[model samples]
Target: MYQDEIIQRVNNAAEIENSNEMLIIRKIEESEKPMELMLNENDRISDIKIRKLVDCIVGRKIIAEKVLLIRDHFVSLHDYLDLLNSGCLFDDEYDALFATFGNFEISCIL
Candidate 1:
């Protein structure tokens, strides 16, 4: 159900069966200079999510359309323990992350 050569396989299948699916794709030959932004501890989790969204979509011909686009940065025990002491509740953390993802999906659809 999953293949990396999706486009080519789909195109070939369309040719074999003469499918009427219109896959309108234009090759964008544009290149962009790499940009950088520095983030500090003061940045909110939502800001971090927006930065990740920029990495996913801006100036790219192909994109991975998945909800779980960004990975967790603070995976170690020390990270959570520090946040634990800093008073970031688990429910609030979950709410912020999911809310960001929901907004990101809506933005992409619109």
Candidate 2:
């Protein structure tokens, strides 16, 4: 069921004209499980899959630009991920993060 949900999200994201948005949605889908578990103090966002996704986004200039624009503040992708993984963000901060990653529309599902 979870896999199906992810696939649906991927398809929806693919409908967007912006390839970066599509990629961001796919990353969010990839990291959804870890992100949910990350709310627990015992779980960490340093999980390999999440890290690799972050790295991929950071490595791509165009995607990184889109991410930075969504951030609305200058910060490297590594820093953004670190802040997110730290689990200390306020509601608005988390919202901004989701918006930056093109996941705002489906954030409730996340």
Candidate 3:
């Protein structure tokens, strides 16, 4: 799954950087509003996978520490997925552009 792949890549990068912390992704059925809370009062919440939760605590820490490489990687992955879901992958122009970076293959069984 794309989510698992993203989590693995982020965790691998974190491990290489000697950061033992890892983020967790959760799915909520229904909620009035998305919120982020620490698992415990003493423990810091690295990332919260709630919808529409702006002002991520961990994201701020990453930026504040100036870890540009990891940040860029995550941003790029997010943008690529967004574009792909928006049907940009089917467009010849975008397909060629993405191909220049790497081969992106999508196979479907219909």
Which of the predicted structures, 2 or 3, would earn the higher TM-score when compared with the native? 2
lDDT of 1: 0.41
Candidate number achieving the greatest TM-score relative to the actual structure? 2
| Residue 82 accuracy (lDDT) in model 1 | 40
Evaluated with lDDT, which candidate comes out highest? Answer: 2
Ranking by TM-score: 2, 3, 1
Every model: Cα RMSD to truth? 16.2, 16.4, 19.9
TM-score result, candidate 2: 0.23
Tens digit of lDDT per residue, candidate 2, span 12-102?
Answer: 7777645754333334455443332112233444556455655554454554353454344323444454645644444554554465443
Model 2: lDDT to the true structure: 0.47
TM-score winner between candidates 1 and 3:
3
TM-score of every candidate: 0.22, 0.23, 0.22
Off by over 4 Å in 1: 1-4, 22-101, 104-110
Q: Could you give the candidate ranking by lDDT, starting with the highest?
A: 2, 1, 3
List where candidate 2 sits over 4 angstroms from the true fold: 1-72, 103-110
Q: What are the clash counts of all predictions, listed in order?
A: 0, 0, 0
